[model samples]
Target: MIRRRPPAPLQDAALVAVSLIDVSAHFDAGEPLRMACAVASAFSLLLRRRLPLLTFLLTLPTVLFSDAVIASLVALFTLASLSRHRTLLAVCAMAFTLSDMTSLPSPNLDLAQTATLITLGYTAATAAAPVFLGQLVQTRRDLSLRLAEISEVRDHEQLLTAQAVLAKERAQLAREMHDVVSHQVSLIAVRAGALQVGTADADAKEAAATIRRLSVQTLDELRHMVSVLRASGGRPTELTPQPSLADLQQLVSGSGIEAKLMTDLPHDLPPTLQRAVYRTVQEALTNVRKHAPGATASLHIRHEGDAVRVTVTNTAPTRPALPLPSAHHGLVGLRQRAALLGGTITSGPTPDGGYELCLELPAEGTA
Candidate 1:
């Protein structure tokens, strides 16, 4: 029987130390032993990075030629444990088996027994080490990728939430501004027209008195709106009374739009749906006054089972359309209001050469 010869302890230790030193020095550009160290260092680096073929090829010759079996075993262990490719590890095991079977001097044991023992030992080490190590590394990499993706998604969600909060605050501020300014301006216009039309001193005095009364009312309303705005801070609240479908008739009548209202609204409709309908009509009337002065308008409201539909249509202006000097917030505000109630609003030129606004909102409980 052929007995395996264990490597000398000092020689085995020296080879391991040399291999480690070579790998460390590979990072240095000005090392004296750079050229000689390159051979071992390159293989060591490949093994660390789990490049199986390169590691196997570089270590194989050294293992087969050296008299020290311990050094050969160390190289094989490095290959099996570090490399990811199973085929390369198997090839290295086969090479080690061939080297041991052909080289070992056996007086009693046959060649087949030597080959079988070497194959069994090398195969066990190569299969067990590389597979376990590879799985551990892959698992770590997968976990890192998942963490990175989660962080990205969290960041995106936070950004969207911030944007939504900002938009809501802006809309609230705009609503406050419109409510305060529009009513005050209308009062001013009414009083100013009365003053312009008056002829006698007594009539002028009466007009001035009317102007004073209007101004006081405007100031009071503005104060109330500002107080409400301040009390809310930056948070969105439903504290303000939203206008409902009934308010649309008042808005149109006050605007001098010659509007006709048609409605079939259910008594049990949601406040949000009513608010969306009212805002849409109000915005459409405002647009008619600004963009098509002296034109007639019509408002149609219908509650059809699961949904509420609103349509506002206005005739084209006969005179030259004057450019509106103020900001166009009405339509945009109406759209936002509709969207908040899970509704849709559309405004554009009608096929009959007029402007039109159409809105739809889901009924209560249906949404």
Candidate 2:
């Protein structure tokens, strides 16, 4: 079962009441100065969330002058939970330990005495308990947020994978229908029309015309279905704007890697080739950012003979990369795209521990 945190105001009120009770239990009206300090320490719990250091300083007077240490401990905990500076937290914890230990009018600080040593140890442990608990709370909160973000990204990636699969299947089906089924249907309609024009019998001529009309209607419907299939996933992000060589500059600029692009390709390439080249560079840069953190990349595209070649190269990563969530579909998608365009995709580590992705496509793309 999941637990919910209490409302902020309610938690603050509870801490303030607890602090006040601790103060009242330790101080009497006869010592007005200690009483005043205790009251101030108790009320300072209200600022623990927003001004933890101030709250801790305000409560320190009570710990120094009286035995009411609960308010100061809470303030130390608040500061520990909110602050990231380890040195600051250690100093604050030490301050709490000293203040609690010196609460007496004539404090005993002789470490040689067993009783004094025991008192110091006890006071140190008390101060440490809240600091450790507060640090633990801070770590748990950070871990929860990271887990939430990871979960959200995983779900979104899964959705995109499903959409990509659907789009690929639809495009393949459309190709089959247009290339085979449509060709066969058109031939049948042509043969029927020829029979209608040559046959002498009226019944036979009428039958041929009917067959021709039905075949034509079926062909029209198949055309519509094929168009629909080709246009599938247009609403989704898989294949929105048809990218070309002109967009490569923008893609490299926004890839977050120190990247360079050099291209000298013919401007009359097919849309399929342009998009494939664009995606190859995009995926290579993304991999650099993910697996090869702090790597610089260069993309080179050139036309040689009857083939267009694209290469993306990155230097060695400066530091070890974190274990980012990955499904390993980016390169697989690149391979599938190359196959569809009658091209080849190759990727491997370079000599200097860098990475390279190369794509080669026929000048006359299959698509």
Best prediction by lDDT: 2
TM-score for each model: 0.50, 0.60
Q: What is the per-residue lDDT of model 2 for residues 1-367, given as tens digits with 9 covering 90 to 100?
A: 9899899999999999998888878768788989898998899899999999999999998999898989999999999898999899889889888887785677767778899889888999999898999999999999999999999999999999998889877876665554346545655665576677779999999999998888878877886787788777322223445667888898788666689899998667888788778878877776776678668998889988888999999999987653333335457657877887779999999999999899999897421
- Positional deviation of 114 in candidate 2, in angstroms? 3.0
Candidate 2 — which residues are off by over 4 angstroms? Answer: 104-112, 200-211, 232-367
lDDT of 1 by residue, 65-183 (tens): 33223334555555554556668666666676555444323323253677767765764564346455655766676788999999999999999889777665754764756654754
Best by TM-score: 2
Clashing pairs in 1: 1-108, 1-109
Q: Residue 13, candidate 2: how far off, in angstroms? A: 1.2
- Quote the RMSD, in angstroms, for model 1: 11.7
Report the CA-based lDDT of candidate 1 relative to the real structure.
0.61
Which stretch of 10 consecutive residues in model 2 shows the poorest summed lDDT? Answer: 233-242
RMSD of each: 11.7, 20.6
